[model samples]
Target chain A: MKKIVVSLLLSLSLLGLGNAWAVDSLNISLAPEQANPPSPQMGDWLKFHSVIENSGSQAAHGVVAWISLVQVDPGHEQPVDLEDWSAHKAVTQAILQPGQQVKVEWPMRLIQAGAYRVVISAVDRETGHVMTSPFVDFQVRRKPVVDSGRILPVALGVPMLVLGMMAWRRYRRRTGV
Target chain B: MNPITLIARKEAGELLMSGRGLAWLLALSVIMSVLSLLLVSNTELSLLDNAQVVYMVMGTVTALGALLAVVLGSDAVAGERERGSLMPLLLAPVTPSQIVFGKMGGQVAGWVVMYLLSLPYVWAVGSSGQNLTQAVAYLALFGTPVVLGFGFLGIALSARLRSVRSALLTSLITLMLLASPLLLGPSLRQSAIGKLFDAVNPFSAAVNSFDSVVIDSQPLAMQINRLAISLVWLVLTAVFAIRSVRKMEI
Candidate 1:
């Protein structure tokens, strides 16, 4: 009985030490609201919801979370201007507790259609440490080319005729023909 | 026909047959064809692409129209004086105002040719596209006055100068000076002088108006300040041109 009790006490103390030694860290995840409309089109307003989790034992204060649209270029990624992209409601969570999470939303308008990556970054004010989430691949497609198929020829032809007549009149006058 | 219309028709015929007219037409055609092909060949379409193309077309057309005005009106009186034809023209039944109006009309005809040349390209990019009609309408509305204003200024400078070469040079220089406000950097553009220049300059006003209407998708009513400024400039320039014509010798 004594041996069994000592064994149990040792295991419990070790578990407590392990729990006490746990480090503080922040985690973030971003997700789009709907499965449908998976890809955003130009001029479409998209909502990105991000969950910021404090995976550590302590509370995090002045935790700022921001979402950014980035274009992956050769050898580097360029940040798209939020102003030009029509981003709105970029949110921040002031306080997050241990094992607690807060949700933030970024409502952005897809102004220019192209391939991009959505990135969410959280900065802990106390530690001045910044944590970034994995890139969310995205593509914006252009609206289909407007078929003005029949109108194209007429549009071109009428102008050509007008220009030709003007030129011909000038030619006749110049040559006195 | 009105005296202005008759004189305008005669002058337009002369311009169309001239070497410069053919050159401008050829250049303009090539530009429009290339731009249209590029715009249509693209598989994906967006409002920005259409707006950008429209903006490019507007800028190119306006600059070219201004060039035509300078080329055609710069010699309205000075070149005639140099060639000893001013006396006969001034002695004709048309008054000085009529002559000015006639020459202005001829420049306007050139502008019409440019506008027509750009229509197909504009249509290809803008038809059925958002803000296309507004872009085209703004181009026409503000574009007409811009061309007319530049033509009047060119004719005024030509009337004031004695030599064709001198008049042409002076008019071109003045155009460059007017466009300087647009070339300034962002920091400088916000300065007092920059603000003053942009407020009074017709070209800048028109370009800003285009931005507001097309890119911002603002209605025409929102562009009253810019439109008003351009109109004021147009009137001032026209008045200056008329006064110069009246005071012109020979």
Candidate 2:
């Protein structure tokens, strides 16, 4: 009677653990999730491109995106809370459907001029699956602006200005400037 | 003949005889047409392109018309005053209002002629993009007045200075001074300063017209604000120019 009770209890525990959950019928791939050698100019606008693909047999829905700025080489993650950068959770629209690949544009200006790494990935908001892209690397250095040779417009504009002034002054003088 | 119509014909006829004026007018249309074609083609590649191309071309045309109007308008009264030809016109039977109407008509006609020449490119942009008919109609109707308004404003300023050279320079200088305020401006329709700039700036008004017609695909009725603003400028310019002409001392 003691053995029978013990066996019955053990059987119930095993039955509970035996129930199965279904496997995901979708696959996701990310393209160039990292950007290297980013623009070094201070206050310069930056845009990086990421492409997403649904490789699985089943269509995926409710895709979500995640991007983080990280230190390169050592790979420390999520240094910048991009949500704080914008007043919204995501500056971009949130939802994407499966088997419908779309490009994601990630734009961020460097807060400090130095080396940095960006990691990007996506998952279905409904199903928790991560899609990671190839890593891209970027470096920050001094970007030249108005440091060398005269810009064409100003260079060209000077001559035009001279002529215009001369012509204008003459015109004004004749008719009383 | 109506006083306005007579003046328009006479001024347009005078401009026709001017080789430099004709050349500039043709060049402006060609450059604008080519630019319109390039811009339209570029926008055709995108789904969200707006009526900016037409805005740009019209802005250029209106700016030119305004500058020309000032240069020519100053020449109309100030030149006559300087050359001492204004006295005879003052002695003539026409009233200040009639003279104003005539001068306004002529200036308006000059702009209309230049606008008509750029139809091919203008229409092409419309046909290629959205709202081709609406764009053309807007340009034909409101655009003419916008052009006239700019011209008249330049002339009005010219009249006040009593010197063609001073009037032209003042108008051009005013135009140059405007660039900073426009770029730094926020909310052309919302802010008082921005609205004031739009009210005074013919180029801005013309650009607004294009945006309404081509980009927004809006009807002529919707553009009344811009048209009305432009007409007010035109009337003001006419009133001042006519007064200056009638009060001629040469």
Candidate 3:
């Protein structure tokens, strides 16, 4: 009787473990498969390619890959939140059979100069399986703001300003205000 | 000379000689140059994409054109009556409807001049990208209706009101309301209300049309809805202005 009870408990524990393993079978990894770019310039486009694989014995359906900015420079913050950053495009795969791999690309435009890393996550909507990629680190340096750009405003502003002043003075003279 | 042409030419000439005209030209010059200069100075490819440059130029031009419309048209009837200049035109053989048409023509002419002034900057920024001609074409095609809509709106307001102060203030407020979408955060701007505003506001429609054409590279079929909505707004405003002018007293 004691032996039978121990055997039954052992069987139930193994089943639970198997279920947990099955749910955590999705793997996500970054692209280039080599040394990533250490420093990318501001206003540059970086294609963050990701690969998703299902290592479980069962098929995964409705898998979603979410890309998010995990961190930035101490002083530099994104103008928008994580949702807006990823809102431009969505990465989703309808189904991934066991041992099947899929590739996805997240095109990002760097608007601010700073250090940043992106976190890619793959989630199975049906089973609530979640897999996260390691932080991808990169630095974006600032480019010099051209001084020549001011010429347009000055050239345009000065003449308009002068003309406005002349008009104001004339109006004052005519109305004696 | 045709009464409409005469009115348009006279109005155009007056704006060119007035302080307001100079101010408009000056504002356009500075804004355009500054935008170009920023693009030129930014060495990064992503800092200022060709599409982005085109978007900026088109948006600024459209917004400014709309502003000029309000500034000029807000005073059309009210200011004229305030200064006792409407009496002469009212007493003239030209019909009130003809005068309204003439004013619309002048507004269109002013917007065209603004467009012409933006050409150099548009060329400089747009040429950097592969689609200068396309950007210019979109600017011209969509820009006309934006000017017409806002111009007519201002004219209608001016015609309905007896005080130039009230007309100008109301016009400015309306313009601010139309442009308020620009101030919204990206998330909020993507909300239901934001989408509705973009579709309903002629100014926003023009900007979105440019974005669709230039940035997204969407074909005209995809953009037909936006252009159509803009045209509807323009036509409605024009009808309202004509009615107001028709019902107004000397």
Candidate 4:
């Protein structure tokens, strides 16, 4: 009985260590591309590069990586949906070999003015383990790209001009002007 | 002037200079103006991506253009017949094909005016975004075929049907059926049947092309398949319209 109990405890400890090893095998680092503007304005395009390295002896299978944005403003903080910013949000790697490193490039447009932190998160489907990169902070300054005042004149004027012309043509035909 | 040109000019003048045509154009401009103002001035909508704004404007313009085409095309033969004016046109020195082409020219004129009117709105919403030129170009490229195809479909129905009301109703219903796929969510659209319908739907092709070019920043080479679908619609409808007019009595 004593020997069996010791064997059971030893097996449990090995299984826990294996699970921890799988969880720590993948490491991710994310950063803005050097070509990106240091101070981005609203409507500016930005690119980010993330590198995922597998350091363990076992390979990572069915790994998926995606970007997440969090607005860290003082008064309002919330996670942002990337639906408008990017069409291809998540990328998958079928199999990542041991000691292999893969790079992902994400191109996004800054739509609103705010302080944001972006992070790359990855999950290994085989191991059910997740890893996240350190957040990269960025600021998008307010730049009014659209001028409604300019649009108002054309939007309102064109129709009015057409109506005036129609009325004038009718009046001329009636009076032979 | 050639018979076709003369007939085209007459049809265009009747549609553009008439009170009904003026009313349709006016309504189109007002709707566009209100939509543009809201998109630019609203706090939430203003924050949307510029390419998204452009895509929305392009879609709206195309829909409105198609609506105008259907209205005018439905009235092409049936309205004239109802007013006892089609007999004189039929007796003129023009073939059935020529009449169909001339009426199509009128629809083209209406589309041109609508496209021109939409330019300011497109520019206002999408000037700051990427693919501005591509958006404008694709709108013209894809919108022309889709709008013209709807016009041809309307003309075909009008030639075959006895009354303008029935033709217009049927055309409107067909338009709604074709446009229904657009309202489906992405998940639903990815289903097997949905994907199959989208593959053949010209409306989907145009809107999807706009999304790809404006929002996804895809190149023009990628739009060949979708453009082909739209072109196929145009060809099929044009042939149907010509045949229907040729077989019509009185």
Candidate 5:
């Protein structure tokens, strides 16, 4: 019984040490509430935006950030194309000093109409300390659109030509062309 | 007096006496010089900038050169006939071809002088770029043919036509046609049925040459097609002008 108690105490102490050693180096949060989200029109894609803060005493570097997205019920997580969003995992070079925060905008696309929940994560360079953003929810809808301004320039040009012709003819009659 | 020398000397002397040509020369020099200064300052005297500077010089000089060509060409035979000097020139012992060639030479001489007058200003603009030397080389060598081409059309038109006023207006129209690519390149190239406009247009060819030499770092080889087309037009107009002069009974 004494040996078993000693073994249990050792394992508990190790677990406590492990939890204590983990640093709180970074924090991330959505900066603004997107009240009225714009529909991802044609050629538009999905995007996630947030503010990342290095709350620790030292400046943070080698930051690898991610945006994980999932559908509501019966959820499935999918990887994002940084190129499509023009944001990447390698903001590692940025050194944000203590109390300094950087705004990150991530773009994404929805191929189908649905509800989505997005979560952002920021990992520190050396410590590997992680910070997670609040989950932001959005809805994507499908609709049809028609463009009518295609012929506007040409349509306006004809009337301008007619007015110019009338003025030119009047000038010719006066000047004897 | 021989037809060519007399007409050349007489026309040259008149141009020298007229303050109008000098005024244009002064304007051209000022304009080209200022353009060179602006470009040279931006280019920091790079060789490419130098070429652009030379091109700017060429552009300004050519404009002035074309203007002089048009004025001389429009005035050539028509102005003479309008002022009652055509009869004396026609009545001379020289044949009509000799008279035509002589008048053409005089007009060409005036244009050459006008082009020469812009050289100092051109050099100033091109001082920063590699094209300064190349431009000067081309100006002294290839520029004459261009002058001949533009001058030929104007002079030939004057020889065939009897009204200087009409010739002047037509020369302006021709200059606009020659430069249409500058004004109409995008509209004609972008709109519906743009393909036909690009294919048939000679002005596009000239603008292409300008782009190659001025904007792109290409040599005169790229402009050979434009040069050839211009030469063909020159030859056809010359033939027509000579025929018209030969056909003139008076």
Candidate 6:
């Protein structure tokens, strides 16, 4: 019974050590890069800075951080795909040592007008633990970049003009006008 | 005027000034008008970036230009043969190479008209975005070779194939194959085989160049390799068209 108890204790300690080794100890904080960011408008470019720090005793290997934007507008609440907003969505840090902090900047263009929440998420590749920063809230004012009213006239006018010309030409050819 | 220019003028006149030509132009304008209206008025599409809309418009224009080229070129030889007009042209003083060049000139004229017609829509869609001028410039620079290459492909097929229907069918299928990359999902286009096909496809090169220049705001210097691929396609198709016309049995 004494030998069995010792073996069980040893196995439990080994498992605890392994769990501790794989535990994620990363913290991330995200904020606008500018000290006082202006009110964002449609078509405006903005940048956000995310700081990832390792708060554990061991190094965190293969840390990847990405920025995500979610439209929080009442009727249109959904995560925005970063494909059109930003080209560089994610940044990778090969190894983050204990007490080491890595800063990443994401440049995104505001393509739509709405209320949005931006969050930075980081994952430790080895531990598969995901850590997300607190949300940064912002509102984009509407700036009419494309005037549909102006486009409507040209869109509808050009074709009408071409059709008129075609009809006139056909009439002239047929009637010898 | 030289025989080449005379022939080219005649071909272009027949294609551009005829009732059919006017009808095609009217159709193109209507399509552009509808596309622009939908893009600007639709809530979801309007929310897209202006540059993205411009890129889409440019892509559609290029495809339309290529389709017109293929249609015109397919009819260049086979339609004439069907109408019993090929014998006189073949017996003329002009060489087969000259005739091919003349037909290519006519296709270029059609593409020019198409490009001009697309500008207003491009401007209307992208006026509020970045790289508007660059997008227009790249469309002309890259679009010409792509359209011409497809035109030559059509002419080559028409010269070799005895029937206009077969020539048009083959040319359109070839165009579909070249444009297959555009139909692929983003992830699939990044695969090795997809990359290889895109690298060689003049159509993809034109579309990718438009994406890079218009949407991503990439500089022209970065697009040399893609431009080279388009030029290579133009040269290859031109050679093929000439050879086919020369060897065609009247």
Candidates' chain A TM-scores: 0.62, 0.49, 0.67, 0.78, 0.54, 0.73
- Select the stronger candidate by DockQ from 3 and 6: 6
TM-scores of all predicted structures = 0.70, 0.53, 0.67, 0.85, 0.52, 0.81
lDDT of 4 by residue, B18-73 (tens): 77777778889888888887767754443455667778889889898999999988
The per-candidate TM-score of the B chain, in the order shown, comes to 0.87, 0.78, 0.93, 0.95, 0.81, 0.95
Model 5 CA lDDT for position B93: 88
lDDT of each: 0.73, 0.56, 0.75, 0.86, 0.61, 0.85
Q: What is the C-alpha lDDT profile of model 5 across A42-79, one tens digit per residue? A: 22355556878777777777677777766674454454
Off by over 4 Å in 2: A1-177, B1-7, B33-44, B177-205, B219-222
Candidate topping TM-score: 4
Best by DockQ: 4
3 or 5, greater by DockQ = 3
Give lDDT tens digits, candidate 2, residues A40-108: 543343556776655555455566666666655345433654532222223233444445566666766
Say which docking band candidate 4 falls in: acceptable
Model 6 lDDT per residue over B1-250, tens place: 7887887898778766687877877888888888787766654433356777888888888888888899988998998999999999988888888898898888888898889889888888888767889988999999999998999899999999967999999999998888765567557888888888888889889989998888777888999999999999999999999999889988
lDDT of 2 at A160: 52
Q: For candidate 4, state the interface root-mean-square deviation in angstroms to 1 decimal.
A: 2.4
Q: Chain B, candidate 4: TM? A: 0.95
Which ten residues in a row are the worst by lDDT in model 1 chain B?
B178-187
lDDT by residue for model 4 over A40-129, one digit each (tens)? 987788999999989778998888999999999998799998877776688889999998999899898887899999999998876665
Error of 5 at B26 (Å): 3.3
Span of 10 residues, lowest total lDDT, candidate 2 chain B: B42-51
Off by over 4 Å in 1: A1-39, A47-65, A71-79, A87-107, A111-138, A142-163, A170-177, B16-23, B31-50, B83-85, B125-130, B180-199, B216-222
Q: What is the descending lDDT order?
A: 4, 6, 3, 1, 5, 2
Residues B11-80 of candidate 5 have per-residue lDDT tens digits of 7766654455545545555555455445545422323334444565565566567777778878888888
Query: How close to the true structure is residue A24 of candidate 6, measured as C-alpha lDDT?
Result: 45
User: What are the per-residue Cα lDDT tens digits for candidate 2 across B159-247?
Assistant: 67778778788777766654333244235356877677767665566567677666554667777777776677666656666666556
Candidate 3 lDDT over B1-250, as tens digits, reads: 9998998888786576566676667766776666667756655544336567668778877777888888878877888899999999998999998999999888988888888877766766655453568789888888888777888988999999877788788888988888665455346778788878777887777777787777666688887878898899889999989999999976
